[model samples]
Target: MRLSVWRIKYTQRSCSFLRSFHRSFAAAAAAGDDGKGCGPGVSLSDLRRAPACSGPLPALKPTDSHTVLIRTDLLRPGKAPEPHPSPDQLQDRWDDTHVKLPCSEHNLFPTDRTTDQRPSKALSVFLQGLQGSEAQHMFGELLSAMAQLALRAPRLLTQPIPLLRTQRCRSITLSQEQVSCLLANAFFCTFPQRNSHQTEFSNYPDINFSRLFEGSSQTKQEKLKTLLCYFRRVTQQRPTGLITYTRQCLQRLPSWSSSEKQFGKLHISCEGSIEDQGYGMLQVDFANRFVGGGVTGSGLVQEEIRFLINPELIVARLFTEALNDNECLIVTGAEQFSRYSGYSDSFRWEGDHDDQTPRDEWQRRCTEIVAIDALHYSQFLEQFRPENMSRELNKAFCGFVRPGVQPENLSAVATGNWGCGAFGGDKRLKAVLQMMAAAEAERDLMYFTFGDADLVKDCVHVSRLFLVGSVFRLLLQYYECVCKKTTRSRPQKTLYSFLSELL
Candidate 1:
């Protein structure tokens, strides 16, 4: 009798979802509903550059790329959008005014011949091996596929202007907690020394563990760059405009303010009002151990990376401020890149997003020991890789996603939408992926992860990389920014100097 009652209750609970399904199946690709102004049979033209003209623009004609999109701008304003300097609105090179390039370098797009484009062989092989359910899946194959895509035909590898320029999560589903967790995981960790005299002086705990990521041995800078790419890409899916740029929040959290320490003690290591709490030590230890494949101490690595980066991430609390998510995350990529490598080369158009955190004052306080040029950056991948670095990236990447985790709420490729509108919720998603797979097989090329890098390099890589580079460069310029806004009578000490030795 009890079993019957429970089963009846369970069925009643799940029936609501059944009612919704009967009303309409959920859209496979949640975002193909671009109905703002686009109509059936209309084709979309390429997105135009932000024009210099003063006149009003025409309505969007429907097509594949520009298809119907709900004008998100129409959504009621949350807060007055913080305005940052956009690249489009910037002053042109002093030399010329007409016939200019969209980004910094004008000579990016190739003009010579169509015959030069060759299919990427490596991508093709890699994608062929991407099949199977999540139970046996590994993500490293996808990374290997992307690395190999770099060598393929420039055309297939190249992307259109706006498409290349910005970084957004490919598919949306990850909540702020997930993005923060990923960032918390990607960070390098540091623990303060335990002195002899004070039996329990410092509250800072030991470092935590980490799941080792497999890849070619890489220099400190390169590791940060590659890791940054993964972090930003993951955040792109289903982006809430609020998270467009994560900002800084240096104010103390009320919870940590209480005198009593609970989950072990935390030390007030670095004095002053800089960081709210000195270090999330025990968690940092877990993070470090995991990154090294569950091993410990790789000689000078911990010192090298710690000195170069902020081994300690501000303790991650479950409190993800809903309204301020975008501002919190806006500058995160830059912050992470700046913290560890000490070679802040990050740059981005600072739009209007701003939080209460006094950014410029807090960042300038730090500095880096070794600075790197472009050519040498790619050469540092040897240390992390045991044999073939690219292959190792493939192995470790796949291993991370290999377990019980499914590629949550992912929608496969859509064929009818090919060079046209999205194929959408119909069973077409599966078919489209098959077609992409088939096309991939024909040329021995693959387009996976965040899609073609070669296409991105010529069209968008310069701008995005510049943004990253600018962030690091700024770190060098104002390590003191990490120190917070200080305007005392005497000159203040440099803050970011914590990175002067190792990296």
Candidate 2:
């Protein structure tokens, strides 16, 4: 056959090619630069004197305009400060006096910062670039704002919350104006850096602003325009309304042995983004343990892209330590500046986003978000392990819990496909886990499956059954009745099919 002849010819040609490659490699190894054969030829002194190995490495130029002084705590070499309450314990230290500080720290920055001392080398570099831009008039003003913020409340940058101590999450209300100032600081790459790698400042990996100014790419240009718009808006007249940033982390892990679960009254739905529908309640940011992940560096995905659109969240990098599995970060008042189409690498900033959320009594916008990091499964099925499930359950319970007698005060949870995209988690499994956690916390659930239509119908069915009994009891009922009936009469049913049977 023609196939047999072609196969013989292909094998013969490949063998000949390999032999030729081997001969070339052997010849190259045998011939030394000194014309010697397969023997050591060059002396250390000769190598040092050679043309290629003769010069000192280029030195970094020091800035002449200002003295660079980076904060010591920001450079804390290893492990983020010991997690508060020692990770295993719970603490409720919230009181009226702790809420005294108004959210907007704009007064922390002044309009005139002409002093010679610069807080960081990064800030100095940023100033140099600002001089060439059309927005030069706002440079001195922005610097003054940065100096006022950094100098007046040096403690804000220095004294991070010692530990994850509070039982109930607290909200820090910041004005749109204050957010603009802080964002402008982050935009210019003012934050201190340990190095380019994620080794040293692991908790703050995406803290620098270097990547924003690196290339002339369209994404970079659009991002720049968005920040420019924010700066211009704030300069014209500082936005009057306030935005809130809430810090959420577990005070203690939830009980796994408890048989009595509280499946409280709830309203659940599945649809578009949590940001668009869950605007008034607490939205979930499926985040990284390091908080911002690589938003300020190279990453551009779920949470990282969110940070890009709302640059104010980048400030959280300055203070948030590395998170424990049970910990989560929450920000309430971040205003989205740019609207984009597509996901990750295909992401394109379409136009400006107008945030019209009304402010509360404290002047903070109704834009609460709880940043919970889901487990990433490299092997896919690893997420099904009992221990991993327990960890996620505790994490979500801590986030959903509201410490108060009144149920009406607690906000419902809005989330979906938490670790399903880049993390490779099963969509069905994560949705079930979120539901179980919400059920235990007695909070309503709102899921956005990111356009998975089938999940919407399945979630509706599962939610109805979930409302009938405790999470465990419902599971027991399904196993006892649903499984028994299905296995004897028909083929083994899938998890979704079994759960939907209860409806």
Best by lDDT: 2
Compared with the true structure, the alpha-carbon lDDT of candidate 2 equals 0.53
- In model 1, what lDDT does residue 453 have? 32
Stretches > 4 Å off in candidate 2: 1-176, 193-200, 241-244, 256-259, 262-271, 467-493, 498-503
RMSD list, candidates in order? 28.8, 25.6
Maximum-TM-score candidate = 2
What are the per-residue Cα lDDT tens digits for candidate 1 across 311-427?
213211111121111112111111222232222223121222122221111121111111100011132222112222222212212211112213221111111111111211111
Relative to the true structure, how large is the alpha-carbon lDDT of every model?
0.22, 0.53
**Which runs of model 1 end up more than 4 angstroms from their true locations?**
1-5, 24-334, 338-503
Q: Model 1 TM-score?
A: 0.19
Indicate the worst ten consecutive residues by lDDT in candidate 2: 42-51
**Colliding pairs, model 2:** 84-163, 84-164, 103-173
TM-score per model over all chains? 0.19, 0.62
lDDT of 2 by residue, 379-497 (tens): 65455455676787778776677555244455566777887887877777677778778767766666777767777666644443343223433343344444445534332655677
